[model samples]
Target: MPGCFINYRTGDGEHVATLIDRELKQRFGSGEVFRASRSIDAGQDYVRALDAAVRRCEVLVAIIGPAWLDSPHRSGGDGRALDDPDDWTRREIATALSLGTPVIPILFDGAARLRPADLPEDMRGLARCQNRRLHHRSAESDLADIIEAVEVAAPRLGDMGEDESSEGDSGQSSGGGVANTMRDVSGGTVAQSREFHGVNGISGRTGDMVFGNSGPVNTGTGPQYNGSTVHNGTGDQIGVQRVHGSRNGGESR
Candidate 1:
């Protein structure tokens, strides 16, 4: 399996990091993932270690939260408390874009809520990639989605040889297959969530289905449903807003 570089907000960074690490360990015997918490050494070397980890990875999964934008690194304010471009998560996003790596923008909080000016220009370039949503308080389902995305983005040789459940040697299974352990702030888990496969272009949960592809295939079919698929109190589609992932429970989409 290829190493993964996770780009997420500090606030929710630990939660997302934990989920990714668990899945990686399950699949590759705990040696594959370069998680910041466990991989980083003490002192000044830690910063360099993180940068090295980012460079070594093939796929960059950015766990986007509402605070993604307005980063201090981009603003040049706060008396330059953090180093230039250091605090800027956008810089990492830009690096991924520049490297032409497969960038998966996992929508935690709604990305649509951001105005164009509020976001890093590179993130706005996401006008075309596949965007996934992890509903409020739904960590387990989100964890499953993360594993699925990893399978799509970074699969190892052993993974090809065995079944999906075998992908996780951790003894955790998603029913008959591998399982993802996720819990919200309240520690409650969510059932299966909807996900799109092989489709290019944008697929977000903001308001209505907003997507378009310039390629031969048109994946602009609109929102996909899983469960009840009923309208909310206002009679609007229920799964519109982009709820973020957290140790605390997420909103039911």
Candidate 2:
């Protein structure tokens, strides 16, 4: 069963919905999130599939973009899409509300807070529920907040998410702590800390350094030097030299 259902308008909030689905699937498991585009199979009765998914989901996220409230109706009517009784976005939200599922309103891309007057009668209650904001500049933090909220609302899903996370972390060495493997180090050092728990390994190249580690591993990169001399801690001398074409160079003391 899906732990969360994403309700979003096709042309208005679809992108945001996809983002939410991807993030949630990463945090929770793939089976825990239900998005119409991915969850519904070809030749399946879409209506029935949507209804079943909505009913079974523990939480419903209503992705409201700037144009969501006033988008054109599917039937080419002049009124807003939400005003139409047949609008899938409207129906999905209504069904989730009727089922007493926790409906979370996610304001996206500078969308304003929902007002009761702007919603159809059935969806007016959505305005009363607390909302979370997702902006491009603050997406990471916002996503974290959404995940935390979901964890609190559905503890079972939370447990499963944690398990999956731990499994990815376990691929790193035992002594490695959680850290950001990807960072900008153009001018100075960037320190990152991350907690790992799962079987996923870190493998990537940033600048001149290449990292491929399985098991808990902490790595860092700093300024490279060519034929530089340095004093050892015990008053000894050491020389550092970089081979022109090689990633690793020999050091002599």
Candidate 3:
């Protein structure tokens, strides 16, 4: 069962739903996050699967994009798809709300906050839910905020690593510890240490090693061979001896 269910319209917030699913899956395990396109298996009843997921999930994220409120219904004869009861997006959110599941409204791609007048009677309560904003330029930070909110809403979903958990708890800006390091440096030079060791040789005809800005560049010492070798390392040469053996004990020459 999923702890988080992503509810989104096909044409309005599908991309944002995918992004949220991926990020949540990474923080929580993949099994803990649900999205229709990826979570529903082939030949399965999609309606049943969606309803079950919504009922079981601890949180339902409703990704509302610019077109979400005014998108046309699939039936091609509607004022807006959200007003239609058969619409999956509307149904999923309605189910979550009815089941007392925490519903999170995510505003994306210049979407404005929801207004009660814009939604049907059943969905008007969604306008009262606090909303989060996500923009292309600040996606990382926005995602961090959403994750923190989810963690708070569902403490049972608290399996993130220590570093990430701390980041979420502190309400720190994105980039994790790297952002903290940059913030702490006032005027003096800040440096980070890193050492790369290879058990075997690191050699190639044409290869490049890249490092981030925080650390000094240092490549390990090793011997270079024209062709790929079993091991490439700096060491004393040991004597090589040849042994004569016979296959199946047939003969030796």
Candidate 4:
């Protein structure tokens, strides 16, 4: 069973959730962390799979972006998506809470601390849970801290992490499967996170392609440009000019 379950709205903190899943798996083995979209395969009963994962997990990491609670109340209801009985995000969190599973609420994308009054009756207890903040600028450190919290909540991970130090493999999983992609991406400046091993530089044209990161950038009203020019170092570079491999994780919708 996956010791950790990552929960987030598709369009909200999904990217952060993906990042968390990737990092956690690396530190604690691939089977220890589960993200529904990536963990559930085609034709599977996703409803049952989601519930099983939540119930089996020792910890649930709730990725709450700014829109998590601010979303429009469904069907003219009082609260937001939580008011909807069918909302998977709400259901997952509620199920975990109901089972008394330790939940780690991660605030990202400028999300504020969840307030008890903002939560519906079934989830008000969520507001009382101690939380952590994840920011883009402090991603590495924040993730390190979050991992520490996970280790505490899911004591099972303590033994797994001891022998799974991926210290040398982190960030090198670049340009893996489906390394580069561009689809339905219109105009504007496209930016993505990339890692080059001993490479001096890289550049691409308007119609060129590069891969990795949350998703393609959508720059409405502006032209999209993904080309880049940078100097890695002043020395004679001895680097792999090209990187190609299967992507290690799932892409955003």
Residue 165, candidate 1: alpha-carbon lDDT = 52
Distance from true location, Cα of 22 in model 3, Å: 0.9
What are the RMSDs of all candidates, in order? 22.3, 11.0, 12.4, 16.7
Query: What is the lDDT, from 0 to 100, of the residue 138 in candidate 2?
Result: 93
Which should have the higher TM-score, number 1 or number 2? 2
Q: Relative to the true structure, how large is the alpha-carbon lDDT of every model?
A: 0.53, 0.73, 0.71, 0.72
Cα error of candidate 4 at position 143, Å: 0.7
What lDDT does candidate 4 reach at residue 136?
88
Q: How much lDDT does candidate 2 score?
A: 0.73
At residue 161, what lDDT does model 4 achieve?
65
Q: Which candidate gets the maximum lDDT versus the true structure?
A: 2
Q: Please give, for residues 62-161, the per-residue lDDT of candidate 4 as tens digits.
A: 9998888867554566766777878888888898999999999999877889889988777887899999989989999999999989988888897556
Report the lDDT tens digits of candidate 3 across residue range 10-121. Answer: 8888888999999998888789999999999999999899888898999889999988999997879858888788888888888888888888999998998999998988
lDDT of 1 by residue, 52-162 (tens): 667666767777655555434434566331234556456666676777767777776565444445444655654455766766588678767776776677655236425
Candidate 4 has what TM-score?
A: 0.63
- lDDT of model 2 at position 244: 23
Q: How many clashing pairs in candidate 4?
A: 9
**Segments in model 2 whose C-alpha atoms lie over 4 Å from true places:** 165-253
Error at 24, model 2, angstroms? 0.8
Model 3 misplaced stretches (Cα beyond 4 Å): 159-253
Q: How far does residue 203 in candidate 4 sit from its true spot (Å)?
A: 37
- 1-253: candidate 2 lDDT, tens digit per residue: 7889989888888888889899998777689999999999899999999989998899999999888888997778798888888889999998888878888999988898989999999998899888899999999999999888787777888887677667557533333433334433343343333322221222222222322322221233344333356555699877754312221111111
Q: Total clashing residue pairs per candidate? A: 15, 20, 0, 9
